[model samples]
Target: MAKKSKQYEYDLSEVKRLIGETDKNYREIAAETGCPYASVVYHGRKIRGRVNRMRQEELNIEEQQPVLSITEETTETPKMLSGGTALSISRSDVHIHDAEQEAAKMIKAARALGLNKVNITIDR
Candidate 1:
């Protein structure tokens, strides 16, 4: 069995500062900080959200504009399931309380289906 790697710790302040000062990509930041690329992306989003919220608060806007809006013509494509017979998932269908639970549910469902590996494609 393979050992799971530990998650890297990062200072929120530093993350905020770097995001504000530079337009570097998440992968670059991750490489420089020795953290996972996902972590870098997550932290960058968090920092951006906080900053945006602060700006909104300062502006005292009664209502905020929607970031995205769905129209009548918009169509959502059905998700496709593909791959092997032990259990691998590219995308997931189950809805759970958290991402961890969702992932577990996907794994369990794949096992139950006798799928060795599976790939899920979401057409949007």
Candidate 2:
């Protein structure tokens, strides 16, 4: 008589939820779930396929409805700034002292705008 491998009982819904919520790779999910990486990939793919089919059905229902038109008129006058206004300082015009001041100003501005990283590229 052949013996069956011990199966770990877990909520399939929870497994699917974790996999969808995180960007973790299959191996990471397998480690966390105590399942084989292959199984994780297989089950995850199955769950995602099912969800996609359900979404397609919902979209088909929505497509049967008539589309509504939306229009809005602007009331406020548009204001435009001319050249050499607010932070229009050119890189060529930047001296060592000016660069330091500009760097400080940029740091403050970036923090205010909640920027995580900034990339600057110079072209000749």
Candidate 3:
């Protein structure tokens, strides 16, 4: 099994962009973002983590804009003696850039709710 890294409040995308677009090292980026140096390294390596909470408001506004139309349901089944049913999921408003992070959160929620199956579709 893979080890899960702790999440930080700073944005990973911003860290990645700085790493790619600037000559500054991790220490400098960490100083600028008010985040610890180790957290910067963890985000740079793309280990398991959560998106920055600092962008929550911005993400919510983006979700409100709604550029895509999603009708949200499909019945799926597999052959079994005592057939079961899959509960429907509520509408998930996911942003194009934050799909992966949003999906992670969704999966976490499902697990917390003791759900056994989960399916996520990211429409480009």
Tens-digit per-residue lDDT, 42-107, candidate 2: 877775554444575776786566433222222333222344232222244343334556656655
Candidate 1 worst ten-residue window by lDDT:
65-74
- In candidate 3, position 11 carries an lDDT of 75
What Cα-based lDDT does every candidate model obtain?
Answer: 0.53, 0.55, 0.61
Using TM-score as the measure, the top candidate is 2
- In candidate 1 the C-alpha lDDT for residue 12 amounts to 54
State how far residue 110 of model 1 sits from its true place (Å): 45
What's each prediction's TM-score?
A: 0.32, 0.33, 0.31
- Score candidate 1 by TM-score against the native: 0.32
The CA root-mean-square deviation of candidate 3, after full C-alpha superposition on the true structure, stands at 12.9
Clashes of 2: 0
For candidate 1, give the lDDT of residue 39: 68
Candidate 1 lDDT over 41-91, as tens digits, reads: 777777665344356575455234322221112133323345422333443
The better-scoring model by lDDT among 1 and 2 is 2
Clashes of each: 8, 0, 0
- Runs off by more than 4 Å, candidate 3: 1-74, 77-87, 90-93
Q: For all the candidates, what are their Cα RMSDs to the real structure?
A: 15.7, 17.7, 12.9
Query: What C-alpha lDDT, on a 0 to 100 scale, does residue 91 get in candidate 1?
Result: 39
- What candidate 1 gets wrong by more than 4 Å, as runs, is 7-12, 49-124
1 against 2, candidate with superior TM-score: 2
